[model samples]
Target: MTTPVEPPVPPADTAPPRPGRKLGPIADGVGSVHRAWLEPLRHTYLTSGLTLSDLSIRVPLAKSKISELLRGCGLYPRWEIMHSLSIQLQLPSWPLHRLWRQAAFEAQKSSEWVERSGDKAAVTTSLVPPLDHRAFRETVESDYSLYAQVFLDDDQRDTAVSNAFDILWLRWNEALASPDIRRFAWEALRATVMARTPHIDGRPEFGAAAFDTVALQHLTTETERMDQMAESLHLFKAMSWLPDRQLDVMVMRRLYGTSPEAVSDLLGLSLATVRSDERHANHFLQSVICPTPETEGKTA
Candidate 1:
């Protein structure tokens, strides 16, 4: 006779919400490290499709520790915490070790949390604050999986893609990993940062989020300008697929919004060459984007 495996479930009333309380040694370790400690943990339990109770039963760490970490505990992840977490996650020990080491390194580097305020966020703060615990877990795994796809070893990217869940993540992986793709991750991330700036701490306030009338209208106008700029980047990414001269024109115009004369001068091309390139780009976009039922069009 054998015992049937039980389904995982969230614990009821985990450890009375230990917020504002002083923590122990392991908790202290977690506090001193990167916010990404949960990245590995998320991959472990959340990605593996297990719940808190399931893991606590396997690992020695209390369910509360896991819950607290996910729910915004101030501690960074510890090796023992990771070991127990990986065991509960049922990952191979070797891969789990890599993840553990990577978590420690990444947490130390902590680039993602360099928000506009540039405040060194303690483990108590999140980089993207809009994310809830569940949402945050999904974002970390998804974003890092994209990073893995872009920068990871071939075997790593393939494995990550096989495990990834959505189009956003899929595109991100493709954007980051493919050498032919030209590192759009930095551009997109830069745009995201630019978009965030006006609404952020250092920039002049413009909107009702600032709770001002004319300020809000100015905010609206600035926001719309940013949206157009952001939308234009997607168009430029597509144009990069065209011939190099054409790509240059489109990038100068759309990506940076530079003038044709400016682009020609920069590339040492004649004005005619730049104009011709622009015309070629427009023709390609029209043929592909404005295709009719009678005509076949390629996806950008």
Candidate 2:
């Protein structure tokens, strides 16, 4: 019989077990817009050759949870997970955060939920607020508060503004490095406020607070008040239908009396653009609220 039979050698293609499974395609449930950022993340993972196990070790998530995130499975993962993953993947967190925020909204997560999750995540990783951030807050806080108050109660306004500031604080390094910090901060504030602002037919609903404006507070007679209220409602409805840039311009210039130059700087728009938007917005409103006889004839 036999010389001892040599143990069979494994095939050359048989390799050692990988550290973890490779990422698969994003789930079909993930929207195309979401895929915009998720694709980059998947590419980063693939190129880095970091396995699911690697992400679990780097981020605090479990291996299964990390896998679900990369594949866009299950509920939208928290901002904490996204933020940590961004850090590990060496992706710039600021742009990722913006996309993640949008995804969170699409996922039906409330603004309060987003704010709370972000606050909890930030607490663990937060550093001292940079001096420039503090200075920036001081410059914009009052106006931001007033703007938010248009859509929220005093307490809610304070919370919204504070949450915006917190977001800016977390991303201040990126903000400072950007070409225009004012515009960056303004966007953060706007996003925070708009997330909380109620919508009707996919438009920001300002009619609820129409009665609260200073313009309406001085009317003494019931008839004058009712007429003004009707006009105010019409005006606010018209404003709601304005394109976002025009609405922003009208709100700042007409409601807050901000100068056009200031609106340009805050919105990261050119002065000419801001002025044009305001003019277009006014024309749209006048057409809606007080159509000229010639326009009325055309409609007739």
Candidate 3:
């Protein structure tokens, strides 16, 4: 019998590219809403081993359009395209639909436009939130509301907190996979509130907000009020200069009277780290607001 000859193996350099290899990372400077949904879609596409051609066939989008979507280039995609892509990728459609709506709003698309396009997508899911998500919201809502109210009116504070929860819902899978869900949630909440907060000289401006603080509002005598206002101004200025983590610790521990253990849990920090941050913040504020002769001389 004649011996069979095997074909030569291709060199690694000349081998065919892996599925989805041409899909680049999402473009920089995409808005948060775009980043939030694009990341998971990209991840799902990569893992699904689907190439652009395959996706184009399955998603009713052109290959070039699919490429643009994966890279976050071109115009913000409509809900119909996103829904079709999500179905092909086997991703949950509800979160993507919500994120699409938010992105549409960010893009200055009107409610009528969103509703009309959403009608085209024809996506529907239960209105009820997941039990764990609801529990997480309940657990953090009080502290988050209080913190936001420090920088915003009641209406604005509620809106910020609600938006934060919506963001968390969009990234629920990633949050669950994170090392600390509390820290993830805290960051989302902080970003949402700060995006609406007024800043001066790159620091959060507290002048007007501080005047409305419960501590300041409760002062009775003029002398006491004047003294308190002066001290508070100095304190808030110094507090603004504190590093972000230390500032958070100080706000929770001193301003809100949260226990170290609770602050630790809330911030996803260890108790020791919380205590250390508290001590450091206290020392820094003291040095700034009440410098001794030696410190004053050094600064001078």
The C-alpha TM-scores of every prediction are: 0.28, 0.65, 0.79
The model with the greater TM-score, 2 or 3, is 3
lDDT of 3 by residue, 87-203 (tens): 887666776787778778877889988888767777667755678999988877998887787677888788778777877776677677666678778888887777777888888
Per-residue lDDT of 128 in model 1: 25
Cα deviation at 66, candidate 3, in Å, is: 3.2
Which candidate number maximizes lDDT?
Answer: 3
Q: Better model by lDDT, 1 or 3? A: 3
Candidate 2: count of backbone clashes, pairs at least 3 residues apart or interchain? 0
TM-score, cand. 2 vs. native:
0.65
C-alpha lDDT (0 to 100) for residue 247 of candidate 1: 54
Q: Which has the better TM-score: candidate 1, or candidate 3? A: 3
Model 3 regions more than 4 Å off: 1-29, 32-54, 89-92, 123-125, 293-300
CA-lDDT, candidates in order: 0.42, 0.73, 0.76
Best by TM-score: 3
* Model 3, C-alpha of 20: deviation from truth (Å): 5.4
Better of 1 and 2 by lDDT: 2
Candidate 1's C-alpha runs over 4 A off are: 1-40, 47-50, 109-300
- Clash pairs of candidate 1? 30-75, 30-76, 31-75, 31-76, 150-176, 150-177, 206-215, 207-216, 208-211
Tens-digit lDDT track of model 2 for 106-204: 788999988877764553333346687787788778878877877787776886687677667656655665556776687777776776688899898
